[model samples]
Target: MAVVDHAPGSGHRTAGDPGGPGPRGLGRIGAVPPRRRIDPADGLAAVTAWRTASDGSPPPRPVLATAVRWTLAELADRYPGGACEVRVPPFGVVQCIPGPRHTRGTPPNVVETDADTWLALATGRTTWADAVATGRVSASGERADLSGLLPLE
Candidate 1:
């Protein structure tokens, strides 16, 4: 599953892009979020809201953002390092895995995905292979694969 980089606002849409199955997201701009510590409790609450919204609608942006950041933070703690960069855009980004840390330019290993896909994968609702196969995730460079470390239970 190789996804090439596209310019910002390139209008590139994956099979089940940011909005996922339904009209989940109106539209979104992908960007790195500021670094912050998100309590796992807050994160879990937001994720729960996203998963059990009943209306089949996504949680509010900030709430969803919290979920994204919390999972990313958890991942970082699990595999502490600067080897890989995981991006769930317009929400959060985190450096993770154990490998050579990039001191300049972009990190070699990078994983990028929409908030919906990220939420699904992060919480075990979806698997890494499935997301890649469906083009719901973009991964590049060595060490980018996060198949072994996911579904943050």
Candidate 2:
């Protein structure tokens, strides 16, 4: 199964795993605030009402989820690397960073974090090293240092 950063109400790991790469090998940025559970229905309703009043048009179907999926896909494609891969639900793996290709089981490098954290990093709100140091991200491999190619913003 594809790795997912967010899973309903289950909180993610807050500390980076030691068995993998070292902490903040890149540089310190900031930590992402933990997210609270949001009722899908309630969120959908709020978005729908806001859209209708704001644009006088019907709300898009599951627009939030769709947007998240799109965001994941865009990032995955933007940072393609044969050694590493970004995982988010609804959007699959994307080859980023042109390099020696890997066609085996485990990739040489990999960085996995939650959807919120990923979004924050993508939007220039967070840093890869900071997230990894705070245990918000789990990364491995030599070239897995994604500090340079982040916050696609």
Q: In candidate 1, what are the lDDT values of residues 55-92, reduced to their tens digit?
A: 48777888888888888889999999999999988988
Off by over 4 Å in 1: 1-35
lDDT of 2: 0.58
lDDT (10s digit) by residue, model 2, range 15-106? 25322123532223443334334454664454444335434653344554443455555555676556566664443345456788777688
- Report lDDT per candidate: 0.83, 0.58
* lDDT leader: 1
TM-score of each: 0.74, 0.52
Weakest 10 consecutive residues, lDDT, candidate 2? Answer: 18-27
Model 2, position 22, has a per-residue lDDT of 31
